[model samples]
Structure formats: C-alpha cells, structure tokens
Target: MPKEDQNNLLFTLQHDFKTKLFLSYIDIKFKAVLINSSTSWYKLASYTIEEKNSVLSKIHLHLDDFVTIYEEDHEKSYAIIKGIF
Candidate 1:
C-alpha cells in the first residue's frame, strides 16, 4: 500500500486503541498483546482460526505489509492492523 494509506491506517489504529501492541505473535501461535489507553497490556489469544482469517482479510493485513514499528519496553511493537470499516 502507499505510504499515505499506511499512515492513515496507523492513525486509525492508534485512535481506536490508544496504545499499540508490544511483542505480538504473528506466527502459527496467533497470540498478540494490545496496550490500552490506561497503558495496561493485555493478551489477545482467544481468536478462533476462522475469526482471525476473517479479520485479516477485512483489514488486508498481510505478512509482507510494511508496518510502522514502535520501540516500547525495549521490544519492537506494532499497531494491531485493523480496518476502519
């Protein structure tokens, strides 16, 4: 996606969730952590395979998609890619 589009997506992600995720697992385990507005980190581990696939498709979040990284808690973090719609 274009840089402008990517920025818009990132902005939406931040606005919706306030804080970004830290140390999310995009591997086979499909585990992820999300930080809330209060700065508390929580795990997102209950997503079923079918639900995950559906959300992934809706957001167009591909493995190869260029993501903006944030360095938090001394680890590389990323915004949970979600669609505005």
Candidate 2:
C-alpha cells in the first residue's frame, strides 16, 4: 500500500475511535443524570461554549430537565432528558 493510503487509514481509525469513546462517555453521563447521583453534570457543563459546543450539540440543553437530541439522519436516540439531575 502507498504511504498516502496508510495515512488515510490511520485517520479513519482515529476518527472512529474518538466517536465511539465520546458516545460511551456521554452514555454514562446521561445515565448518571437520570439516576440523579452525580455532580459531574454541573462540573461538565461549566466549560466555555467554544470548548464545549461540538460534544454538546449532540444533546439538548435544559436548565430544569434532561434532553437528548440528534441529527435527522440519526434515527436512534442517545439519551432522553426528562428529570433534573
């Protein structure tokens, strides 16, 4: 295989791993919120908007409720935001 092909493969794998890791992290965090057993939510959202928007965009923001949203192409829901943390 050519060097360029190898670089492309590496980039693809890195992107996949990052997406998976992120989904997993958010899943755990959502469960914690539903169970109302974590302060991490508050700590987690304290970051600046620029630093947080990408990951945050995957979910809906609520002051008194939990909300999970997704792109139109994403049929499955990641999290359901109902109860407050």
> Which candidate has the top score in TM-score?
2
Question: How much lDDT does each candidate structure score?
Answer: 0.48, 0.52
**Predicted structure 1, TM vs. truth:** 0.23
lDDT of 2 by residue, 1-85 (tens): 9999998996786666556656887976865422222222231232334344464423335544544567689865556443232
lDDT of 1 by residue, 1-85 (tens): 9999998996786665542234333333556644454433333222334464465322334433455676656777556533322
Candidate 1: lDDT over CA atoms?
0.48
Against the hidden reference, what TM-scores do the models get?
0.23, 0.34
- Model 1 — which ten-residue stretch has the worst lDDT? 39-48
How many Å off is the CA of 31 in candidate 2?
A: 10
Candidate 2: regions farther than 4 A off: 30-85
After the best TM-score superposition of candidate 1, give how far the Cα of residue 51 lies from its true spot, in angstroms.
Answer: 37
Q: State model 2's lDDT.
A: 0.52
lDDT of 1 at 40: 30
Regions more than 4 Å wrong, model 1: 19-85
